[model samples]
Target: MAKIAFILLCHKDPEGIIRQAERLTAVGDCMSIHFDASAPKSEYDRIRKALDGNPNVTFARRRVRCGWGEWSLVQATLHAVEAAVSAFPGATHFYMLSGDCMAIKSAEYAHDFLDSADIDYIESFDFFGSDWIKTGIKEERLIYRHLFNERSNKRLFYGAMELQKRLGWRRKIPADLQVMIGSQWWCLRRRTIEWVLDFTRKRKDVMRFFRTTWIPDETFFQTIVRHVVPDAEIRSRTLTFLMFSDYGMPVTFYNDHYDLLLAQDFLFARKVSPEARELKRRLGVLYASEGTEFRISNEGQRLYRFVTDRGREGRRYAPRFWEAEASLGRERELLIVICKKWHVARRLAGIVRQELDLPVIEYLFDEGKTELPDLGGIQSTIEKRTRHRRALMRMLFDYHKTDRLLVCMDPRNFELLQDFCADRATTRLLEIQCRFCDDYLTGHAKRIGLAGEQAGPEAMARLLPTIRNDLRHESDRIADAGFAHLNRMRETAGPDENAVPLAAFLSIPEDKARAIAAMENLFSD
Candidate 1:
């Protein structure tokens, strides 16, 4: 068996890590884990106990603190790599695994690809003169420019930009120099690993520059690798079986797309939720038997076999929904309404109930399952409220019974709601724009003349009527245009009288010359 070291960096999800290790043990020669220093001691102890008696598993002594857009994660990764290299010196490749990652292909196929590729499989991109540099500037003038004009994070944008300039860093890469951006999660050959570690150790200035930088994990490895070997035959994309968000974060895979997942040509996927256990079991069985094929029968449809690893296949039956009995006297339809603020969601629930004459199932994660509070005294915080909104949006998309979805919030919040709805396969959406009554607007003079100050209530009131009218007009136009397009597509074009010979009529539209074509020419082999 080929030697491959698996290094997993974990924080909270120890169980997830154990499951991944068990799966990869069939392929990987050795596994190493580095726990986050900040994790609870009890949690760490539990993780240690879970790994007990596994001959291939080893735990790192030095723990590293990890946070969003921080350098600690890179430090932790390097530590794990060094340990793995020392323990398994003969290992040809180092495969970095996250607790969330899962294998999608057979071990033999994965090993074959790794051996054949020779080049490192890391997600990389070119970052020369990109907006990423502007994230470091902190000046008020530059910060305001980025916020109002560029539409970026006001504080971080200015901070990162300013820091880069002050450090006497090369603002631009030389014309001869090549730069590449890549994700930290990847598989690297032994030679590439040695080169990466040596270059980082030698470049003290670069190390110092990254120590306090935002999103160092994204930039550090990328900057170093590009500096050393710009032309290295590297696969600057993940070879793994799963697609991730732009930031390399795993996305939730649901049971509905089980067939689609099987069809994809990938070795592994990540972040499988506990809900997908049955799908995982079925996949395991399909891959276990080589040259065997499985067919799925759905509703009276012909059985079709889905191909699996090593040219094997398995049959997938139509999901037996009837096998799982529903509770007696269950609600036929349940519509869940979510808002970050308990009072806002409660108020929206009331409006939905009153307007649509349907009692909504209200969910507020921050607040327990209790009666809705009075709307008058409700205090709302942006962060907490947005979480509830997202949770509600996700629930609405997943639940089939949520036929009608209503969102009662500000314009910005409503936009997010619409985006969430579009992500899901659903057409039911309603928006209720919230506005403050004139009686509530007291002693606050909105400054219209000032550049930075907000516009006045009178100005807002004047704009509301026009906005509403435009919205109604736009909605009608869209509906009419859709119908017109559908009708045009359905209509058949008649043959033209002035038709040329088949060979000479290449320029003529086929729909226009349908009748006059010679029968032999039309049916030619």
Candidate 2:
């Protein structure tokens, strides 16, 4: 007989919370609700009144003024859990949920799944080594004293952190505990939860340290549970489906995402749109029904793709490139081969392919010409290409799972150059400047809709300075030849170094490995 006591930490949407409490209790489970102190009295009253008659529903006696990344959130959860333990002694498991969380699978499935294993489902990773914390102070969050609420007063919070840094003030963590972090939402066994409560009550110093630590809710139980539970009894996954945008905001489910929700194997999902009445109603009916077979989905990966691909709605028009970068995860090592002439690029690609045995993808950013022939046509317009540029590049990189990739792109593509320069950490630029700029000048003149669409010395001269400045940013990984006339070839062999002339470097080589060796030497500090 596996029974779950759901601890729902809620802040808003009284009607929605009441509906969730009713559905959970109706399915023979108990619920412990904690309304944030910031929530209006009227909203709290409405929820309490709706569930007053339900024996399975209980509310936390003490409300805490909870803010994002504040310790009060953890306090509120503890209070709610205390109330729940007293109210539902038969609860075999304690599951943490949020106000907007709704069951995606049936209650029968959750009970059967829990009954199969007394294992705890929580993502607890070593704080220092894990790359889980994408942004902000990772180790510093635990080391420094963070009293101010980041959500309420961001300036003051950061200012205090800076002050502590300048003053060389730091706090030592408890000697017995190892710092661990994960999603705040988790499912723990009753005995495990009891042990955690007892541990927290006895460990005043640990509690005091965490009192001002940043986002203690995400770390508190995660760190505590690891000390008691063996690794075999823990699963590094959450039953609830919670996806955050790369910017750390939760991706909310809407009415149209009903199918998306159904496809996910997660028992419950959170941050559902409050106005999604039809979605909630359909999922509620599914939650109460009996089901034995559970359809599996790689939803974590799928939702990430969803956020990157489908999340582009009116946001493509935004000026900031980071908006798009956030959707397309982290940067990977990328090699960009820049040259004015396509013929030069083709020759270089062939040499690298045959000689160095390295992969060479040609004209990846060319209009109507890409490695992905199927996704090539959209490059006709600058807007279309700019919007889909990072996504296209990300797909290209993903398709070829190699450490280094050689991609040929037109040097005149300022937008592409800007993007490459912005992510200097991973971008390796190799530019082969052609002596005869007439062809490139004419082509660029035509593209910009220049008068008479003809190449002139003046037009070439005007464009040379801009191109040179864009290519040679300080401390960027770059190698180049030619462009002596523009007066900015930093490491190019001077006219005196006759052995490796610009024209000779471009010529077809009999000794291919030696030619590749010479190219590598160009990038020398």
Candidate 3:
């Protein structure tokens, strides 16, 4: 049977650490904990006293004052490793954890998993070749010496690197070692852990070189393990479930993340909030009990997807509803129908869709749910208007594989419509000017739940001229008509090529048609 010895590194939260240590050491697993020397003595004393009697738990003899991007963190880990290896000589594997980490599974399960394989589990990749580092001094992190704590004194830290660069000073890595980088959390077989300890003790030059290396703890063990272990003997992945925010800070799990935590296949998780008493209680039960099986859940996948997408795409940029800009669609035949009342615009859009065999989107820029052609009403809050615009573009250009789209929108959203439609190559702007549509405006205001202050003729009269003048500056396609004209067109139901004014208003003008056709060859595949 495999005996797993956990090495915990922490500086704060003594109660949380004690709870983690007790749960990890419950089923005969051993632990070696290192309290950061910089932490208050009271915290250290509390944890030490609480776990002093446990045979499986021990404290590192030497506590190091750790710092970001410094050697003290790696030194702390080494001290804890020395303590664990010295105390548990018969252990099969050593797992590295933080004080905030807790076991989500029974120790028996962890032992069974490790006993099945002797291979090391860690995240290791060639430092120079991988794109793991998002933003920072990449190659310089290894070649240039980092003397200052990056978190405490960033200006000096970066200034020193600049100074070194001007002098062209660089350090050559040891000839036998290849620099590798990975997550700080890892689980290694006892033989691998012992080998790393022995190698570090003898390689004083290597240790000296890494003492000033940026964030050495992440690279030191990873580089050493990859140097010795054959490719087949290492897993190159951490067993602890972890996630980071866009700011490169570890995400802390709270009680609300119970479903997310329970669904993880990893035996343990890190950076749990100390205030998550419910989460601790539930996970503690799972850690001490048996028969609970770990299964991958869709909830976990969705949470990861949300986080990864947010990191990549970032939050959708949303302008204020009234001040929103019109985002241009893909290069296609786009006809924008704008009017004071959307009901008239909707009727006109239906006629255009029937005539041109195009998809018509009703109230495309409305503040509420957008009425897509076949998708029905998609709930789009004000903040998701950018996303809706992108979806509209994709539907017109990609999904349906169509080249023509007709959109109905109220002139109240015409803040940037002129600029959007100014490009006449693939776009045609049409406006139907209504003398008045108070009933439509009243219903719209009520439906949007703003009838109390926004529905009456006073608000409409004050707002109408500004919207009309806003559209008149850059567009000349305005057709002055009223509800009577719209009612006539709806009664006629179909396009009348010979009808006097209605035909003129409904038909796409000959010059604009020729212009649009002329631009088609430019966009042809």
Candidate of highest lDDT? 2
Winning model by TM-score: 3
TM-score of 1: 0.50
Report clash pairs, candidate 2.
none
What candidate 2 gets wrong by more than 4 Å, as runs, is 303-307, 310-525
lDDT of 2 by residue, 1-525 (tens): 789999999998898898889988898999999999898999999998899899999999999988888899999999999999999999999999998898888889888889988799988988888998888788779888998888778899889999999999988999998989999989999989899899888999989998989999889999999988888999878888878776778988888776556556578898788889999998898888975454353344443553374345334344364534543334465666676566766765676677655667787556454445345555455466566766656655566665456677765454465565565335555566544344554454445433123333553454445434443431132223222211112234443332233223333343443445355334321
Task: Please give, for residues 1-525, the per-residue lDDT of candidate 1 as tens digits.
Answer: 356788888887666667656556644467878889888878888778977677677777578876665567788888888877777777788777776555555566566668776677776666654443444342222112121212335476556555756775433222443344556667777887888888777766566556655565766676666556545677776655554443435566666545544434455556566667766665555434344322211111001111111123111111123312221112222232322223444553564356445435444323343333333222144333343444433344344244444333322233333333333323222222222333222211122111112333443444345344433443343334332111110011222322232112222354433333312222111
At residue 293, what lDDT does model 3 achieve? 63
**What is candidate 3's lDDT per residue for 1-525, written digit by digit as tens?**
988899999999898889888887887889999999999999999999999999999999998898877999999999999999999988888999988887777776877888788699989989999988998778888899999988899899999999999999988999998999999899999889989998998999899989989988779999999987898999988889888776888888898776556556677888788888998898888787877665443234334543365334213343344333434444566656666556566655665566567777777566466654453333345334444554445444555577666667665443334434443325555555544344544454445433333223544453345334444532332233212222122222222311333333345574433332232122111
Candidate 2 has a TM-score of: 0.62
Worst 10 residues of 1 by lDDT: 299-308
Backbone clashes in candidate 3 total 1
Q: Return the TM-score for each candidate structure.
A: 0.50, 0.62, 0.65
Instruction: Say which prediction, candidate 1 or candidate 2, comes out ahead on lDDT.
Output: 2
